[model samples]
Each structure stands twice: as C-alpha cells, then as structure tokens.
Target chain A: MVAIAIARQTVREALRRRVFWIFLIVAVFLIGLGPVLGFLTPKESQTIMRSLGLAVILLAGLFITIVTCIYLIPVEIERRTIYTVLSKPVQRFEFVLGKFLGGFAIVFLSIAAMGAVFLALVYFQGTTRGPDAGVLVWLTSGKFPKEMVLGVVLTFFQMMLLAALTIFFSTFATPVLNFFMSFGIFIVGNLSSVTESLTTSKNGLTSAIGKIIHYMLPNFGNFNVQNAIIHPTTEISNQGVFIRNNIIYALIYSAVLLILAVIIFDRREV
Target chain B: MATVIKKYPFETVRRRMSLLPAVLAGLGLAAFMQGQIDPDAKQFHPKDNFGKTANGGLNNEFLLLPLLGFREAAAGLLWVRCDEFFHSGDYDAILPLVRLITWLDPHAENVYITGAWHLAYNFTDANERSDRRYIAPSQSLLEEGVENNFDIPDIKFELGWQRYDKIKDFKGAEEAFKLAVATKVNKNSDDFPYGAPLKTLHILAHTYEKQGRIPEALEEWKLAIARSEEMLARSPKDYSAKSLHEAEVRNYAENIQRFNNRYSTTGHDSVNPSPYPEVLEPPPGSADKTPRSWDVAFKPELRIVRPKVFKVGGQFNSQDGARIDVRITDWNYQDRKITGTLNDFSVDPAQTILIDSISVRKNHFEREMDMSKDPKMYSFSQDFYRVVLSYNPRTTAPHLLDRFGWSGEGMTDAEKSHVFMDTDPDRTGTAYIEGQGAVPPVWDGKTVPFTNHSQPLRLIKVTYKISREQIMNQKPISENDIVSVQ
Candidate 1:
C-alpha cells in the first residue's frame, strides 16, 4: 500500500514537471500538422497522416521516458528528499517500482493523447478529396481502428520498458550519464537483431560476443507493428499471440531491470 | 582519532540477496521471449541483409540505424531526401537514395515504380548521348520492383511500355503486357481505374500486330474488344471515349478483312480484283479478234470436268471426261506454246509433273491427264494439286492469282509457294490456267461456270471422288498416255 501511495505521488510529480508539458504540447502540435503534410501527397494522405502522427507519438514517448525517469532518483538525492522517503516505512524496492510505474503512467497518457490526435487526422484526411480517401473509407469508418489501438498499446509497453531502464541507470549513475546510458541501451536493444544475425554468420570470438550481446540487450524491435497498421498488406496473421507475447516480454524485462535497480539503491550510501 | 566502525545489517544484506533469484528469473524469461519473437520480426524490422545484395548494398548507417529502432523514421527521412534529389533533376544521386529507401522499406512499392520510371524514361531521355547507358539499369530496377511487388500490375505495365516503346522488343513487351493484364487488381481502385486492364490488352494486341503475328494479334484484339465493352457497361461515364472504342472495333474489322482476303475464296473477287483488261474470244478456226503484243490483254476461260474424288494409285479414270478446257483470244494463237507443271504439295520436287507444249488450235486448247500413264508420278496422296502455267509471255511472270494478282508487288518464288501450300488451306484445289478454256463446260449433267477474268489467268476448282480399293490395285501406265493436244 505504501508502494501504491508513492507511485501516485510519483505520477503527480511527473505531471507537474515543466518538461513533460512542454514535450506534450510540442508533440500535439506536430500531430496537428499531420493533415497539412498530408496535403503535399494528396494521394497518400491517410498514410502520411498516420505515419507522421505515430512518429510524433513515438519520439515524444521516448523523450518522456529518457528525460523524466533518468532524473527521478538523482534529483531526489540532490535535494536530500531521499532521507525523508527512506526515513518513512518505505522500502527501496517499492520506491524503485513506484518511480517506474509513475514514469510509465505519464508516457502512456501522452501517447494516448497523441494517438487520439492521429486518429482524428486520419479521419479528416479520409473524408477529404485526398488520393487515398476512397481506400481509407473502405478500410475504416467513423469508429476506431482496432489495429491502430493495438499499435498504441504496444508502443506504451515499449516506452514502459525504456522507463524501467532509465530508473535502473538512475540508481547508480549521475543524471547526465544515466540519460546517455539509457538512450544508448535503447539503441543497442533496437539493433540487437544485428548481433543476433552475426551469431549465425560469423565464427569464433566475434560470434560468441555477438551471441552474448544479443541475449543481454532488450529486443525493442519486436514492438514495432506500426508498419502493419499503416500498410494492411503487412499485417501479422497471428496478432493475438504476437501482442500477448510482446506484453509478457516487456513486463519480464522491466521487472528484471527494476529488481536490479532496487538492489543497487538498497546498497547505496545516499 | 577513533574511526566510527559502520555496522552492516545482516538482515538487509540477506534481503537484497533474496531478490537475486527474481532478477535471474526475469532475465531468463526475457531471453526466452526474444528467441520466440526475433524470428517473426515484422517488415519495419526486416532482416539486416534482406535487400543488401539486390540494392547494391545499403550503407552501414542504414543497416545499423534501424537496429536503434527508428528504421521507419530513417526510411521516411531518406524518402524526403529522394524526393529532393528527384525534383532537382539529379538522377545520378537519386538512384542510391531510392535504393536505400526501398531497402529500408521494401513495402514502399511506389518508390520502386517511380524510381524505375525515372531511370528508364526520364533519365535516359534527359540526355540523348547517354540514353543507352541508362536502359539496362532502368530495366534492372523494374525487374527488382517486380520481384518485390509481384502483385502490383502498374509496375508490370510500366515495364511492358518500356520494352515496347523504348526498347523496341515486341516479344518482351508481349510477355510483360501479358503479365500486366493477368495481374488482378481492384478496377475501382485509384491505381487501376476502369478499363486499365482493357488498355493493357489493347497494347498487347498492338505489339503482336507489329511483330506480324496476325493470329495472336487477332485473338488479343478480340479479347480487348470484349473487355472494353464490359468495362463500358459497368461504368459508362468512366469509359466515355467512344471514338477510341470505335477505332479499336474498326481495327479488328480491318484485320478480319485482311485475313479473309488472304485465305477465303468467297470475298477475293471484291477485295482483290484482277489488274488486267477483259478480252472476248473469237470463233474456233476463224480470224482471231485480239491483238498480239507483249501487253495484250488475253482473258482466259477455264473449266474442269472430273470425278469429285480420285484414287491416288489407280487410274483417275472418269467415264464422262477428266479434262481441262482452255480458250485464248489471240491472233497469233498458232504461234504460241503453252507449258506448265502440275506440282504436288510435297517437299520433294520429283513427284511433280512437267507439262510440255500443250497444243493449241485456232483459239482453243485442251489438256488431259490419265493416272494410268506414269502412275508413280501421279501416285496416291490425299492432298491438293496446284497448276503452274507458263506461255509465250513467260518472260513476264505467269499471271497466277497467287503470284501476280494477290500482291501487286512481285513475289519471290518462296512466297508464291507459301501461298499455294499454306496460305489458304481450303482453296488449294482452285488451279490457275494461263489459256482460255470453254466458256461453260458440261459436268455431271450441269454446265459448270468459270470465274473468267482478264487477269491472264483463270481459276478452276475440280473435285475427284475415288475409292480406296481402285487406288490400291492400279498398275503403272505408259508415259505416252499423258496427252497434250496441239
């Protein structure tokens, strides 16, 4: 129950941050420009609107995770608020978990808002005399698209995973260093497939090191189902199994990272 | 100074160590999930080496940036850059960028098609001196597009047009157009408007026609007509170009006329009239009525009386009369000599008969053939026989309907043979005679009419009815029985 209260306070604190609101407003503005960009390629209006909208949401979600979550513990320590928190009956594991949940909540809400903007742009682009208007109307109506909703959910899971990594880094490193380290990990995780392929193609030490890196890094590439949503031709056949598996994977990885953060914070002098 | 000794809490250490198992479990689960999901990665996260070879190898940045989980963003950036290069008329720079864009997002079929078009048409036409250099690359790009997006007909249509109009390869154009027509896409869709498929068929027919593939061209034209009509029925507003449709209909009709003119006998007289003047025959043994000159218009009348079917080996003996009547309207008829041959449609020339100097009296001549004479030469064969006639004006090639009249331009010997042996399979029995025969010859108790014209040659078709038993037992007769009355 203490963990739940801390988690709520963390959410409130994140919402209060000037950086969060600034990024949110900027993301919303970018999404609002989607319909204008769509006019440039009137034939592909729906595709352009959806692609740009999703892109804004993804970049905004990443910024929230990396910037907000990385500074959580460092700011708390710098201001000596950790003493007050630790002085309470709060456990170190609960604090780390709360911070992760809080960051995730902020990112999720931002993405949901951006997703709504994206849907509206898509709807407007469809009804207009755009090139793909006919195709869009045939594919979707006034109602929400389930596939797009699924995409949003997967994107939330991805951002949550990134938030956990940031929290883990904040436990041991300075805010600036933690920011880069977390962002680097996200890059490496997305490109883990490169090393995964290397393991099968190369020989000796290179292959062995590639295999280790492939297993150690998070597979963020798995969560990118935006292409399927944008181009129906590439939609996955077994979407149920895919979404379930990815959710499980994100939860497990985040849990593992959070556990490590808790262990490190428990032993820290601060 | 007495250093304060830090008291380590054993319970806290033990509790931290207790969470180690959970960390290990989480890591294990992550590894398992990675293994399950990696193999089924989506298009945005395509295999690093998916299009490396075909795209001439993407740069390390492209191959690696997507691993950072922003492949779509990178592809979008490349697409914008490519558009810039395209608008600036920098085709040389556009190639690599378009290749990278397509590699990053192979599902961007529009990029492939537009890129190939730039290379094949726009770039090549941009510089006359370097046109040849771009042709092969353009074709290669289109081929790659086809490989990646086989379901799209637009790419195939572009390729077909490239081969047809730019490359002048009709066979290749036909193949690509065939695929374009066969590829089924939504007609109502923007990519394929109504009558798009019909247009493809029309192009295919035109290509076949250009190659002189008449039969195939006719078939495609017919199909296009039918499809165009269907399209018009479905969406009249969309297919309101009635002049174009009527033009296609007229083209089909013209082709049908040409085909009939070459093969059918019923419509030959109207379309292919003789280019010679008519001549009236004089009384037998009386003064000839026509002048004697190299350009003398000698109208010949020919008649054939015979058994409709004849035994090949046995004598082609008709109890009534198996003979050809020839009448000429000439003053110097006694000075003229008629010689020709009855050639079989066999590859061997030894099976043909050489007719030498058929005798003429006044203005009339008659030739009779009895298979009893030289049965080996007139041996049994269920095939049509063609007569080749030559007379005093042999220097001016014989006026056979096939050799002199079918085409005003002179024909080679091989072309003439093709006309007799292959052109009209049903009209092979219609033989041409250079001399005039009886105006009307009696046959089977009826006067058989002759198609007499002043073309210097007359056509006479005769049918011979023969029993198989008669042909099997017939003996070879003396060569003297082949008579040429003078």
Candidate 2:
C-alpha cells in the first residue's frame, strides 16, 4: 500500500515536467505530418507513411522513457526527499520498486498516447482525396492498416524495458552519467541482432565482436518487426507466439535489472 | 581497482552474486527471443533489407539504416535515387544502383521490371545490335522477382514477355504465362491484385499461334473470354469491362474464320467442325520435307553502290521466312571461333559491318542499307574487302525451318567460279579493256576469294580486289562470279 502511494506520487511528479509534454507534442505533430511526407517519396506512399510514423513514435518514446526515468531517483536524493521517503514505514526495496513502477507509469502513458496517434494516421492514409478532401476525409478514404498495431505494441514493451534500465542506473549513478550509459547500451543492444550475421563474416575480428555483442548485451533488436510489418507476406511462423515470447523476455530482463538495483541501493548511504 | 575492491566487504558482493541465477535466466531468455524473432533461414532475404547482402560492392552507408531498424524505409529511399539515375541517362550507374535497390526492397516489383528492361535494351553495339549479353541477366532478375512475389502475377507476365519478345523461346513464354494465369488472385492486393488474368491469357494465345499451335491458341482465347466474364460478374456496372469482353469474343470468332479460310486447302473454315492441324496443319514429315529440302535455290550477288550502303540481291525457294547472312569485311578477315565461355559485353565496335539481314524469300531479295547515316559505325578503312552472301539453315526462322531442317539439307548455293584480279597487265582477257590498262583494281597478281570453300553450305562468295578509285565510282565496278542464267 505504501509502495502504491509512492508510485502514484512519482507519476504525479513526472506529469508536471514540461519536458514530458514537449516530447509528446512534438512526437504527435511529426506523426500527424506523415501523410505530407508520404508525397515526397517517389512511390510506395503507404509503406513510407507507416515506416516514418512508427519510427517517430519509437524515437520519441525512447527519449521520454530515458529522460523521465533517469531523473526520478537522482532529484529526490538531491533535494533530501529520499530522507523523508525513507523515514516512512516504506522499506528500501519497496521504495525502489515504487519508483520503478512510477517510471513505468510515465512510459506507459506517453507511449500509449504516441501509439494512438500513429495508429490513427495509418488508418486514415488515403480514405478520401481531390478538391473536397479534408483532414477527416483523408483519414477515412483508405482502409485501416491494422497490422501496424503489432509494431506499436512491440515498441512499447521495448521502451518499458529501456525505462527499467534507466531507473536501475539512477538508483546509483548520476543523471548525466545515467543518460549516456542508457543511450550507449541501447545502441549496442540494438546490434544484438547483428551478431548472427557478423559471426559468419570472413574476418576473424568481426566474428569475435559479434559474439561479444550477442552474449553480453540486452536484446533490443528483437522487438523490431518493421520489416515484416511493411511487407506482411513474409512469414513469421506464429505472430501470437512470437510477440508473447518477446513481452515475456522484456519483463524477465527488466525484473533482473530492478532486483540488482534494489540490492545495490539497499546498503547505500542517503 | 584492487584497493577499492578490498575496501568493499565480501558481504555486499555475496548479496549481488545471489541474484546471478535470475540474471543468467534473463539473458538466456533474451537470446532465445532473438533467435525466435530472427530465424536462421527465411524465404525472404534478411541481409538484403539491411544492405549486407553482397560482399564487396555493398555500400557501408546503406548498412546504417538497417542497424537502426528503418530497413524498409531506407530501401524505398534508395529506389528513388535509382529513378533519378534513369531520367539522367546514366545507364552504367543504374546497374549497381539496381543491385542495391532490389537488395534493399526485394518486394519492389516495378524496380525489378525496369531494371531488367534496361539491361535487355539499353546497352547496344555501335551498329545497333542490342547487346544480347545482358538478356540472360535480365531474365534472371525477373525470375528472382517472381520467386519473391509468389502471389503477384505482374513479374510473371514480364517474364513471359521477355521470353516471347527478346529470347523468342515460345515454349518458355507459354510456361511463364500459364503460371501468371494460375496466380492466386486477390482483388485487394497492394501490388498487382487480380482484376483479371485476361492480359496473361491473351499473350499466352499469341505465343501458341507463333509456335504453329493453332488448336492451343484457340483454347487460350476462349479462356480469356471466360476470365473477362468473371470480372464482369464481380462489377456489373463496369461497362468498360463488358465492352472489352464483347470485343474479344467478336475478334476471336472473325479472326479464326478468315484465318481458317486463308490457310485452308478448300478456302473455308469452321470453328465448330475442327480447329487447326486437321484444318490448318500443312502437310508434315516427308510431305513437308520433299519441296523445302532442295527447292530454295540460292543465287547470291552483292555490290557496293554507296559509301555506307550495299545492294544485296539474292533468289530463294520463295517459301517465306528466309533470311541470308551478308558480311562485308577485310579480305583477310576470318570468323572468330569463340570456344569457351563467351565474355558477354565484348561485342565491340566492328571496323567493318556484318548485317545478317538480306531478305531472300520473296522471288529476289534487294535492300539498300544506309550505312552512310552512321559513318562512325561503318568505317571502311580496309583496301580490299569481300562481300559474303551465306544462308545457313541452322540460324533461319521457323518458316525456313519448315523447308530446310537438317543442317541446311535442302538449301543450295549456285556454282561459284574461282574469279580473281588479273594483276599482270600482259594478259589480255575480255574483262580487260585496251584503254583501261589494268582491269583489276590495285593488287598483286594473286588475290583469292575470301574464306569461301567448295564445301556445301558456304553459300555465295564475291571476292573483289577494288581500290579507292572503284569505291569512288571513278571506274566501272569489277563484278566477278556474277553467275547469270545458263
């Protein structure tokens, strides 16, 4: 019950930050402008719109999750708020869990907002056109491309995993250091998919690097279904099973990271 | 690092180590998920979307997008750049870009079609002989496109057209068109959804007719009509579809009627009674062989009338679809016998022209080619040249094949006498005029006919040792071996 109250307090704090709203407004605006960008492409307007819209949501979600979560624990500690929180009946592990859940709330709410906008843009791609074509008609003329929901769902879970990683780092590391570490790890983690191809490379050195990246880092690339989304005819064996497995993987990995953060923060001096 | 670790207690380290099992299990699931998401072998190419398909030529910059997971969008952008290359006439640049674009977007059907078309038609030899070397590669692209787009018939139609138009392999064309007709038609398909397979059926019928299979052609036409009816049923208000269906039925009925009457022995036709072979098959086997084997008597002759043009006049059996190979080259030129793998793009600019297009079927063949229009292509710097009028049955079209089948078993050349320039002014033949001291142009006493032999199928050879004066019309042309009627 105490953990839930603290978690709600963290959510309330994140919502008031101007930076959170800035990130979302910009992301929504870019996704809304996807139709105009579609015309600039030589052909394959539908493909380009879906790719750009999904890409916008993902990039925006990444910044929102990282920035929101990284500042959560550090600012509380700097302002002596952690002392007040620790004075409560809340256990240190519970406090860390509550902070992580609050960060989770921020990630969920922001990604859900971006995802809804992205889905809306894709659904109304070309339902109406010509002189009478208005914004509402453009959204209605085309058939709703529902396959994009798969990409959006996967992206959300992937960002949640990223949020957990940032909160874990903020438990011990400074916010500036936490930001760089999270971003760098994300970059290397995205390369987790490349290890398979790199292992078959003729160069011995490339093979070694590929193995290291594959085994050591978190697998962020597993969540990317953009290629299959753009060309749905490409087989994936079982979409339901594949997506369920990915969500499970993200949860398990995020749990492991949070537990390690809780253990490390347990003995630290306030 | 050792001091800091020593300062830290083993108790904290033990606590962190306690979570090792959970960490290990998490990483294990992560690896499993990676494998599940990206299986080892898929029908579609994963490496291409990432621009990591080929070995050396692949651009590293192209790899950047896929690394960030925007692979499909990156492919689309590269294809746009490739379009710009097409408009600028940067043909050579387009080849490499096509490789990159298709590797990136294997599902881009239009890219595959345009790339193959450019390969088959763009690069030409100086004399306008389409570089036949690229034909195989072009067909290969279309084949790959079909494999990638299993449900789409657009690429299959292109493959059929390539076989029919360029390669002239009607059997291959028929197979491709059949596959195109059999594609699972989806009206809502993004690329080439099936409104109808009428176009494919139409082309299939034409291919059958070209191969002398009239019965099969008639069936294909009927199938096309049926397909149109299916489309009309789906959209009753589609007047254009209904009219098109009507036109096809009328065209098939009228054309089959007139065609049967013209090809029939009795000058009459009945689509109901029977179709082709029974009514249209010209007598085959021995009956077809007897007349075509030894009847197309070839009387060959050639003369240089203009700087670039030559007058090739020859008589054949008049059985139609007969073409003679006429070659004008240096007197010492020998045919290059390419033995091993042919280096395809090596069809370089020829110093002299060898256009194997002398029409010899209808009574007599006579056409003046205007080589003067393109001097850069047909440069005649050689002093003495030979005009070879040869007809090999192996290379002739189907109409000629109806007559001469067995390595030119029926085609024959008239008797060619060993004619040469009498360089010795002392001799006095009727070919020599008293005022024109030396009748033979300007050559040594021993100038022989070009690579012609007494062996059969060598066709006719006209060896003339003419100088610049003869070419300039300053003197009468020394026409030798002009075998006239006995």
Candidate 3:
C-alpha cells in the first residue's frame, strides 16, 4: 500500500515537470506533421505516414523514459525530499520499485498517446492515396491491425526496460551522468548483434570477450518489430513464440535491474 | 559500538545476498536467450556488405542515429535517389546506391530484381559502342541476387536473359534458364504467369540451337510444346500459350525436316562419291587402266557479270588465255579508289589457274595468261574458267559505296556488277567473274558447237564431262589450284 502511494506520488511529481509537457507537445507535433511530410511523397504516402508515426512514437517514449527517470531520484535527494520519504514507513525496496513503476506508467501513457496520433495519421494518409489504402480502409471500417498494436505494445515494454535502467542509475549517479550512461546502454544494447556475431569467431580471446558482452548487455533489437508492421511480408511466422520470449526477457531484465537499485538505495546515505 | 557495527555489517550482507539468486537466474536466462536467438536470427542478416565498409564494418554514423532502426526509411530514401539517377541517365551512379539499399533491406525482393534489371538491360544497352565492359558486371550482379533470393524465379530468369541476349553466352544462359524453371516448378506461385515458364523454355531451346546442339534443342522444343499444350488445356483462352504452342509445333516440324535432310539419303554423302575410293585407284602405269576422258558439250562464249557501280569486261583470247579488263570511268570521288589482285581464277571443275595481281584502273586494264604454261589449266574435253577479284577501298572516306552512285536498293543487273562495294567501309568486297571457252581437244573426236551468253552479277555455269580414266590421271586437284582456259 505504501509502495502504491509512492508510485502515485512519483507519477504526480513527473507530470508536474516541464520536461513531460515539452516531450508531449513535441511528440504530438511530430505525429501531426506526419501528414504534411507524407505529402512530399505522393506515391508512398502510406509508407511515409507509417514510418513517421512509428518513429515519433518511439522517440517520444525514449525521451519520456530517459528525461523523467534520470532525474527522479537525484532531484528527490537534492531537494531533501528523500529525507521526508525515508522518514515514512516505506521500505527502501518499495521506494525503488514504486519509482520504477511510476516512471514506467508515465512512459506507457506517453507512448499510448503518441501511438493513437500515429494510427490516426496512418488512417488519414491511407484514405488519401497509396497502395495500402485498401488495407487501411479495411482496418478503419472494422478490422484492426493486431500486428501494429503488438508493435506498440512491444515498444512500450522496451521503454519500460529503459525506465528501469535509468532509475537504477539515478539511485547512485548524478542526473547528467545517468543520462549519458542510459543513452550509451541503449546504443550498445540495440547493436548487441554486432558483438554477438563476433562471438562466433574461432579465435578464443575475441570469442570469449564477445560472449561476455553479449550475455551481459540487453538485446534491445529483439523488440523492434516495426519493420514487420510496415512490411507485412516480413512478419514473424511464430508471433506467439516471439512475443512470449520478449515478455519473459523484459520481465527478467527489469526485475534484476530494479533489485540492484533497491539494494543500492537501501545502503546509501540520504 | 563493536556489537552494533558487526550487526549492521551482517544485515547489509544479508540484504545484498538476498538478490544473488535472482541475478544468477537473470544471467542464466540471458545466456539461454542468446543461444536460442543467434542461429535462427542469422537468416535476417543482409547477405552482402554493400553499404558497409570494405571489411564488412557498419557505418557508425548511421548506426548511431535512432533512424537507422527504421530500415524502410533508409531504403525508401535510397530508392528515391536511384530514381533520380535513373532519370538522369546516370546508370553508373545508381549501382552502388541500389546495392546499398538492397543491403539495408535484403528482404525487399523487388529491389534486387529492379537493380539487376537496371544493370543488365539499361547499363548494357547504354554501352552501345560494343564496349562490353559492363556485361560481366551486370551478369555478376544478377547472379549475386539469385544467390541471395533463391526463391525468386524472376531474378533467375532475368539472369538468363542477360546471359542470352547481352553476353551471348549460350551455356551460361542454358544453366540460368534451367535453374529458373526448376525454381518456378518448386515454388508454383499463382502470380507467375504461364507465359513466363514457356518463354524461358523457348529461349533455352533457342540457345541450344545456337550452340549447334541440334538434338538437344529438338528435345527442349518438344518439352516446350508439351508444357504449352498443358497450359492451353488448363486455360483455353490463353492466347500466349496458344501462340507458343503453335510456334513450337512449327519449330518441331522444321527441326525434323532439317534433321532428315542433314542425315538421310539427300545428305552430302549420297550426292557425292567418296574421294577415298577414287584416290585408291591404281596409278597410270598400273595394270588397272581405264579411259578417263569423256566429251561434254557446253557453250564456250558464255559470260557472267556482276553489275555494280563500276563496269568490267572480259574476253577469251584463244592465242593466249582468258583475259578480264576492269574499268571505272564514273569515279567522281577522288578520296577513294578500289584496288586488289584477282588471286583465285579457276578453269573447269576445280582448278585455280591465275594466281596473279590484276589492278582495277580508271580505264581498261587487261590480263591475258598463257594456259599452256601450266598443263593443269586445260581439260581434255572442255574448258571453263572463273576469276575472283578482291577489292579494297583505299580511302578513309565514309559512305564510299553511297558516294559512288550506288543505290543500296533497286539495282539493275548492270548496276549490280558496278556497285560491288559493301556498305561497311571497313570490310573488303569480292566480285566473281566466270566464263567458258572451247579448249582445243587433246584427245577428242569432234568439237561441240556452242553459243555465248552474257549476264551481269550472275555465276557463270560451266558444263563438262570426263571419263573415269582422265579423272584418275589428272594432276592432283585442290580447291587452291588455279587454272585458266582459252
């Protein structure tokens, strides 16, 4: 119960920040610009709209996670709010878990908002012109693209993982340092396949190092099904297995990071 | 103080150690996921490093950008650039860009096909000056595409066409076409039209024909016919299949006729006697001697002329030998003139008599040869002579034939002999002049009377007969042996 209250308080605090409104406005404007940018490519309006929409949603989600979660604990400590929070009956683990959940909820809401705008743009662009207009019409009439929805859901899970990482860093590091560290992790995690490919080498030294890195880093690329959404031909054949694997992976990784954060916060001097 | 510090240390250790199992479990799960995803996911890797570094390294600048995750955007942009280059006729610039686009998204099968098309068709055609530097590269690109997209038969078909039409490599074309047919059969996609497979089979058969593998070509044509018949049976309104069926049917009939004519009773073996048996006959001093000469009556003054823009006249001077005088009085162009020797002149059945130089001048120039100097020039019963004048235009001027008052079309018999020059300035032209005259019979009883006939731009037919004994005793004859008769 105390954890739930803290989570609610964290959400309220994040919502009050200017960064949240800035990201929200930027994301909305970007999604709205999809139609205008799509007009530049008259023949490929549908493709352009979908691409821009997905891109805006992803960028907005990343911004909300990194910008909000990076400063969550640091500002609390800087403003002596951590002393007040610690004076409560809330345990350190509950505090860390509540912060993560609250940041994740905000990220999820932002993504949902962006996704809605993207879907609307996709509908408008489809009705105007393009080869996929028929599909768009079918979708708007009754049926919906479960694949596209799955893409948005998976993207939310990815941002959730990022949120956990940012909160973990904020527990110990300054906001600026945490921000750079989170961004670096994102880059390395997304391109983890490059390191994984190196592990296949016959050279022992290189392969050992690659294997360590591959196992240690999160594989953000696994969540990228945007291509499958845009190019239907490339959709995963066993989508059930893919989604299950991703959910399991994200839950395990986020739990590990959150636990580490709880341990660090419990030992730290406030 | 010591008790409190020790108690706090133990609590801290307990709290940290409480999460060790979960961390270990997470690490184990990550390892398992890595093992499961790597091999199955390798298929999604682009086949080539076209846009990457020479050593297959990624472009860090692009990779660092969040937009790199959106592969479609990169490919679409590259595709637009390719269109721009194609519109501007900068085919050379489009290759690497298209290659990079394909690399960025290998599953875009259309990119591979379109890129291969541009390389093989547009680029190859652009080098129309016969500088075939792009042909191999174009073929290589298609072959690479086929390797990457093994399921796409259209790409293989394009490769076959590239080999057949552009490179003229018949064996390569046959292999590529066969692979395409096999892929089409395996896939059996409904979108693939019936005309496509039929067209490939037809081209394969034609390639076989060009390679002189006539029997194999006939078999392929038969297979094509069968396939077309099947298609027609399935869809009776398929005009493409119907036309292909009819065409293959005609081709089958024509191939059968050709086969029979080449190998059956009407072949060269049946019409001509074996030279081996005649060569084995005993020499003149041997016991098996037979009369070799026989009298054949033929016209002696028959003159055959090839009409061109220039004029040539010849006469049979009995005191000497056959003489031809070539004169070009209408030579208006000073830049070009025709010159060469009449190296090959034949008398009777097969004898080259005159191996001398004869120049074509502005006026008349005659060459009279003594036939008696070479005994091989005369025949016992009849004499027939033929002369070949090889001419080379001695000028760098273009359109020499057109400038010499020679119309490429609608030429009379007289004009045919005069307009002997070919349209291409680089090639040499030859004019054939043959005639017949009486040979004072060496061992004949009566001289046959014959009249002279003259025509321009026509082969002079010489008729003579000889006994088996004369043929056996005749000097060793060859196609190169020149002879003149008077």
Highest DockQ among the candidates is held by which one? 2
Model 3 residue A105 lDDT score: 85
DockQ of the two-chain complex in candidate 2: 0.26
Q: Which structure is stronger by lDDT: 1 or 2?
A: 2
Compute each candidate's TM-score over C-alphas: 0.62, 0.67, 0.59
State the C-alpha lDDT per candidate: 0.57, 0.64, 0.56
lDDT per residue for candidate 3 within A156-261, as digits (tens), equals 8889988989999999999999999998888777665577876887999999988877777777766766655554334345667767777777878888888888
Higher-TM-score candidate of 1 and 2: 2
How far residue A13's Cα lies from its native spot in candidate 3, in Å, is: 4.2
| lDDT score at residue A30, model 3, on the 0-100 scale | 72
Q: CA RMSD for every model?
A: 20.7, 13.2, 19.5
Write one digit per residue (lDDT tens) for candidate 1, span B1-486.
Answer: 433323338798688889999898889888888787766664445534352344245567766655544555566667767777778878778777776766666566667677767765553211121223345566666666666555567777888888777665666788888887776564323335532456787888777654434456667878877766766787787645465577779888775554444333334445544222211212226565451111212222222333322212221111112122212111111211111110111122123222223333343444443333333333334333333232321112212222322211112222121121122222111222223221222111123222221222222212222232333434222322222322
Candidate 1: give its CA RMSD in angstroms.
20.7
Off by over 4 Å in 1: A127-150, A232-236, B1-9, B12-16, B46-70, B74-93, B124-130, B177-258, B261-486
Off by over 4 Å in 3: A12-56, A116-150, A225-239, B1-13, B47-59, B66-68, B89-92, B120-131, B181-486
How far residue B123's Cα lies from its native spot in candidate 3, in Å, is 5.2
